[model samples]
Target: MHRTASIGLAAACLAAAGVAQTASATAPETPATYLERIAAIDDAGPAIHAVVAIAPDPAGGAQGGAQGGAQGGGPLAGRAVLVKDNIETRDMPTTAGSLALKDNATGRDAPLVARLRAAGAVILGKTNLSEWANFRGDRSSSGWSAVGGQTRNPHALDRSPCGSSSGSGAAVAAGMAWAAIGTETDGSITCPASVAGVVGFKPTVGLVSRTYIVPISASQDTAGPMTTSVADAAMLLTAMAGTDPADPATAEAGRHAVDFAAALSGASLRGVRVGVLRGQAGTTPALTAVFDKALADMKAAGAEIVDVAFKPEARMGEAEYAVLLHEFRKGIDAYLAGLPGQPPARDLAGLIAFNKAHADAELRWYGQEIFEQALAATDEAVYRKARQDARRLAGTEGIDALLARHEVDVLVAPTTSPAWPIDPLLGDHFLDIGAGSLAAIAGYPHLTVPMGAAEGLPVGLSFIAGRWDDAKVLRVGAAYETVRSARLAPPSLRRWGE
Candidate 1:
């Protein structure tokens, strides 16, 4: 069967099943009704576990109310947005995909949520995420957690939706929301987006505030957009940027916030310099072909393409892992201390004990060895050294040095290989030659846009720009997406039984 035909057949079968399940399925719901319908569908069919909680009344006063001029009339007015559970919202509990903070609710919104409200977006609900943003355990399933169950990939019902922002990626791809917010410590955002066939943008560390958000590593964590298009991602970023009193890092963000939409001139790619990282090769032939087409597209669009050889940073993953473990222990403790009521699990030791008490609920698939490792560490000096080493190798000696040598505006590579078949028993068997390692460890910005499909699965082309040059990455991604004309469509399956 032709790939498009296969997609159509899958969608038709699913839609038929959906129609049979619901009596009122004659037409797609309006924005208000659509939100409710999708939320119901998510819970019943596909069983995607994409949503952590749905607002009983998403169109209530907190979400701008019914009289709020069609949800504020902003650029994304009338659009439904799914927020990753880790990003705090006063209306719902921010669990960070862990049972530890499942019942804790703060009556204040994260600064970014408030910004989204100001821009007129209808705050749909919270999406599931990897427990503690996947920092809790070694061998953790990327999209499984005690609080929200497991988020399934929309493309393949059984595949992992690589996290820690799994829900955001799946929700957007499944049409549960027009767009969603996803945070990254490393490959969390891009990984899921790549696998789910959506756009994921990891902004420079300070571009979005981390205050009121559940933190893993304050130095590396920043909230960005997970959307179906580069244009939608850019729109969300505009609303998310600005200095906030709660987060000091964002104090420098004002200078970086520009009208990214205006930068989307169809002719912007003309005279642009793009560096293709030749060393990185995807896992499959289909993915490589998709990437080759993307490179050709960029060249045909008048961008200068330079193929550059770059080696994988030695020991970078170990060093970055060390930093995350150390930070997770310290950051969670501090956040718990500031909470108003008794926290579900007060500290790292308390959390470990709680998980032991409820193994079925917490440790069904993975052990908390990562948390144990973080807890076992006693030396602060070693932790600081590991962080510094990671920065040196990934930043000064890796991405920055390579870019300087090539004199390129941005580096491009396959965001990930083709989507792996979904497996519940063994968890994610990802085979992608990832482009995130450099940007992640170096604390640089990375953006991925859907280039085309590999087999029936989608492939993303990554744009890795200079530090604090998120705008440049967004500009180029937007331009390429416009020319490529790839649109994200939801999966054909409506439920597991189907």
Candidate 2:
């Protein structure tokens, strides 16, 4: 029996619930219905604009069927997932939000994609993302992309969706897909997940492969799951976690490759000592109130909460950016060189020139200031000291020190303030970039789950743990999710006025 035969019924049902309730639990929707609801919510109506391309189901026959989608019945089974454009999908072009690479499809699944496919996951489509993952310009908008345009937050259409995982976050929040894959290098994954009020987990650096994904900093880049719930994130991560010989980052992944979702104990926090970093919670009264209630809930759940102090590294900003500029140059060159088909821009220099040639579309809103910087700092001499300093400060003198000092299981903080208004001219005005950066620079595991709503927008509580402690963070997040239960189907129709 084809579940898609009920497409009209699903569409008519969704009309009443609106796009907000796209993740229908009462009725099983067909692939056709998913496409319809996605178009209705993404390209029209609330116009979330989360997806770039909707690929026909690879497992389903030419005519879509619901029995078994691309992801056959396993962990993900018939579940559909939207991948960040940077993560290459053989069936669709991986543009990474840049028109310059519009023909960059390599006809080969990224190792992670292959893993998910083997585990029975349907590659539904590619989601929009920040142009160059928000590394192109100094004053860049988070979700504005040349190929997919700007993705709007479902919580409030006018607010920012925080990049470079902007579309992944929005797609899951808006229920455009069951889940989505997002890459993080700094605030790319968790920040957007926090802003969009979804569960986004950045595994410890080597827990997943990075081969075939667009480059940022090899030091920090890793693909993770952006989903509506922690359980979904865990399920996606298990499929994604493994070793890939092509990418050396996954050398240690096999050791941690476990059924992350099944391993989630979700036990009460009876003796868990959660170190609270109140400093990371910026002076947002609305967010504070919600976080305070969360703390009370944790206490009620039998958690031992304690305050922990972590001073910001004074030179981390300069050193980290320097390392990214350096690694991005080297990493991108290697990625472009390996493309199966010749891309429009074969090199970073070619990409820069191409952007200039098509400035009207690609460079209309922002200039590639970061690109220029990366180009200049490509030499190892310029980046060596910065990379060393960044690692030591973020690791030895950063997260490691805090964890040992506080004698805590993991560190917790507000993922970020509520989503700010999207501004094309002035760009993102986010000020609390510390929490995610702490783990990003340290190459540690970070997970963000919905804490509650701030004003009318969403807020997320972040959990950060030591390197390779991916399961720990996920377990803690699962426990928190149990207590808060703050998540809700996105009401895409709720548009907020500035």
Highest lDDT: which candidate? 2
Q: Tell me the tens digit of each residue's lDDT in model 1 across 257-305.
A: 8766566555367788898986686547787788888888888888899
Positional deviation of 47 in candidate 2, in angstroms?
1.5
TM-score of 2: 0.93
What lDDT would candidate 1 get against the real structure?
Answer: 0.76
Q: How far is candidate 2 from the true structure (C-alpha RMSD, Å)?
A: 3.7
Query: What's the number of clashes in each of the models?
Result: 4, 3
Instruction: Tell me the lDDT of model 2 at 331.
Output: 83
Q: Scored by CA lDDT, what does every candidate get?
A: 0.76, 0.80
Model 1 clashing residue pairs (backbone): 46-494, 46-495, 158-422, 159-422
Residue 357 of model 2: what lDDT?
Answer: 94
For model 2, the superposed segments whose C-alpha errors exceed 4 Å read 1-29, 57-73, 485-489
Write candidate 2's Cα lDDT for 265-310 as tens digits. Answer: 5446778899999888888799888888888878788889999977
Give the TM-scores of the predictions, in the order they appear.
Answer: 0.90, 0.93
For model 1, state the Cα shift of residue 114 in Å.
0.9
Worst 10 residues of 1 by lDDT: 20-29
